[model samples]
Target: MTRSATLDVLIVGGGIAGLGLAGYLARQGCEPTVVEQATEWRSSGYGIGLWSDGLAVLDELDCLGAVRQRAADPNRIEIRATGGERLRQTTIPPDRTLLLAVHRADLHAALRTAVPADWIRMGTTPARIRERRGGVDVTFDDGRTETFDLVVGADGIHSTVREQCFTEWTLRDLDTYVWSLWVEEDVDVGGDMVSVWGPGSEGFVARVGDRVGVNLAARLESAPEPPALDELRTLADAVDWQRPALLEETDEEPFFDRVREVTCERWRTDRVALVGDAAHALHPIAGMGASLALQDARVLAQELATTRPERVSTALDRFEARRRKPVEREKRKARVEAAVTFVESEPLRRLRNGVVEHTPILDLFVRQQAISG
Candidate 1:
């Protein structure tokens, strides 16, 4: 097999992972094309927490400074019981990097600006894929077929690329749902961030730039979907916290989704590979979703930077190996945090809170998640 001067890469999904990878690959002189199912460029969530590792990747793509300008750095977190009893307040050490909080739309815009407009195809979906030596042939829903040295599935949990290529894999429901909103009024959160944990539910408020981001996660008894905002309020009302102000300010619709996890035996097959939520959708409790996706893009870009099209398969394998351990560890942390925050048993909830209050364990764990990839 001969090496090409530039490899053509097809990226599925226009979310954080895809767009971020497109920018990184373009910087390496690879011809990257992104196909988004949505007709226009948009972001789904309200605000995202960018950890140090995620910010570093954005820095590599030259998009961090702009994003930083539009974001708020939160340095402290206040943990409280559902009844507003203060459990513990952890102030991030001065030497540690503060988590940058920004509206998802702003972050998306920053990434989009870095990627060339021509490379992204809006209102498009990959209908079919045929992998051959040194490349893969992809057919779009619009009836166009193209061959690329590499095909990346950066789509989220229900990814088409993953479904078609790794048919054996599936998303595991965590039996929880998350609903979040970004309100114009800044809800009076005591610290940089506040997380209230109660029986069966957890609520978080973060001051992101000029807006307040409120998130509510609940463990459902049955598999029925989470209720709408009005019903959600009733459910959340079971716990006591500063929800009235947050709810009053929440004029725009809330973003709702089920909490699911994806574990793949392999992240790649042939010249095709998965990234971001497509590869491993961890619980959002650890706040590593964006960071992990950004890290995935960075690591994949690094591996692909020095490889030829003929050796792309090996490069992808190396990318998977280098990333898999860290991702799995992150997934484990997310699971543990989810269990602690959403504990329904009153006794278990109190025990967890007592541990958090009496020991430095929870803070250390949070710091570990925040700093490491």
Candidate 2:
């Protein structure tokens, strides 16, 4: 993959990781084709918090200004009880790291626009992937077979590329369901990111400019199919503040899904590799998914751009070796946080609250999360 050689690269999944990688590679003089299953760009989902590391990647792509224009800067993060009593609060020091709360759609749009339009092929996916001597052969859903010097899977947790090329992978169900939506109605959040936790449930509310974004998560014995509006209302009954307005403004189709994590012992083969959620999907409670994806894009693009075609496998190895530690650490942190925040036992919940109220546990957690790795 020398700068002069035209290394044909195919990136699966056109989400944040894929697009970010494509943009970086293009800047390095490599043209990568991205294939997404969606027919058109999806402007869905609630908001995401981007720390300095993610912002740095956007700046490298020359899209930081575009993202900041549509994003909201939050100076504080607050944790509250069900009755709106603030248990802990931490201020985001601008001198340290920056935090921006932007809708998921806006972030996706910014990354998508940074990549060339023709580099993406929508409405189709790779049907089969076969690794050869120095390259990989990919068969698309449209019955076309093509060979590329390298194939990277940024597809996501349920990645087809991972399933086809690798065997030691599992999608661990977290036994939790989440509902998220963004509404234009005003809610009193004081322009801060606020999270409320109740027994077996947690809700996050953040003001993105004039609109507000809400995310609700609850632990369950089993994951169910998409629930009806009435069922969602019942779930919202756990939280008091802004529930009425959030329910009333809920769209006909809101984001609802089971939370799962992807764990893979190996993220690459001879000519194929995985990045972002495809390799290691963490619990959403960690709020590090998008940031990790951006970081993975930067590292993988760097490895591939500088290596030669004959040693593409070594490049893939270097990419995984550099990224696996931070990703695994965050995965463990997310699981621990989820366990503490979503405790169903009344006694344990009270003990957890007491510890959080008296100690600086929440503040420490925020600081740990602020580190971009």
Candidate 3:
């Protein structure tokens, strides 16, 4: 491909979305600079299930092999009652394409390696995004200012870019709190993902390569807030099978956060645009968050690559139009998944479990998330 003239692009956040976009834009002859507020790039999560759609994006970026080398098979997911009684089992649909479970840090490292290190400016973030006539002038936290042809906000849920550009967008709390941690030592998790359902709470254990990841979710009657790790252990003590041991062995500090979904009136305007979690943060129940974000990076790069600098706004519109419907659908389905996972009443939980086991519902969901994400 012939290189086009440089269209100075500034990408906020050095996460997957930003790095992926930077790699793609650089290939398209854009001098893209990524600014991350952290002293170094980092993410708080254990294993992530990368469906075929997500792998396809990585494949396009030529990083699938690297990620696959460190990934594990997400072959089966089991749902069980708090007492360890098996409720349902869903076999991930067979596909020619790969479905992988990988540590978030491994995936991040893969994407980071794809981009030039000098292109990333760690410990730097825009304190102000001043909109110019046809571009944006960003004032960095270090008191440096620069103008760019386009500014892409791949920042996360509490995005400063979104706050500056799309002030109308709001993060809608799902009244859920989550705690996730990884075991320091390898645990024999049998290469399958398990979710244990309890009253107002749910716990999950997934095999991430040699190690195991434990995550807990609770539905709160009031606003969501992070609970202490000991409180998490107390809650996990009621769960079945190896969950208690898994929780106990997680010696590291757990990742705690409120579950939130972003509602944006528009994903882009003027010279500014939002992608990934900054544009739409879905409930984690769906397991499509990273997949969708990588998809956003690919689509955004595709749009910008084909359009001229003067027509950037049109490209942004096309990007949003193509992504919004599928994402909204995922969000809707995610809500249902959350409701079932966090069901409080025993009778309702039994009913939900029965429906999931006896019906083709799970297979369809699995296919949709794998193929459509």
Tell me the spans in candidate 3 whose CA falls farther than 4 Å from its real position: 1-4, 92-98, 184-186, 221-227
The residue-by-residue lDDT of candidate 1 on 1-373, one tens digit each, is 2123377889999899999999888877776889999997665575677888998989888898889888867678889998789899888776666588787888999999889999888999999999987578888898999998899999999999999889767689877888888777846778888889867888888887787888888887665543466657865677668776678766677888788999888899879999999999988888889999999999989888878778888889899999999998888888887877888888888899999899987578666866685
Q: Which stretch of 10 consecutive residues in model 3 shows the poorest summed lDDT? A: 222-231
lDDT score, candidate 1, position 350: 82
Clashing pairs in 3: none
TM-score of each: 0.95, 0.96, 0.94
For model 1, the stretches where C-alpha displacement exceeds 4 angstroms are: 1-5, 94-96, 223-227
Candidate that scores best on TM-score: 2
Ordered list by TM-score, greatest first = 2, 1, 3
In model 2, pairs of residues that clash are 1-308, 1-309
The total number of steric clashes, by the backbone 3 Å criterion, in model 2 comes to 2
lDDT of 2 by residue, 1-373 (tens): 4561467899999988999999899888888899999999877775787876888999999878888888877778888877777888888776654777788888998898778998899999999898989788889999999999999999998999999999999998878888888888866765388888887889898887778888888887765668545556776777666665677875647788788899999999988999999999999888888889999999998888777788888888999999999898888888888989898888998888888888998778777666753
Q: Point out where model 2 deviates above 4 Å.
A: 1-5, 94-97
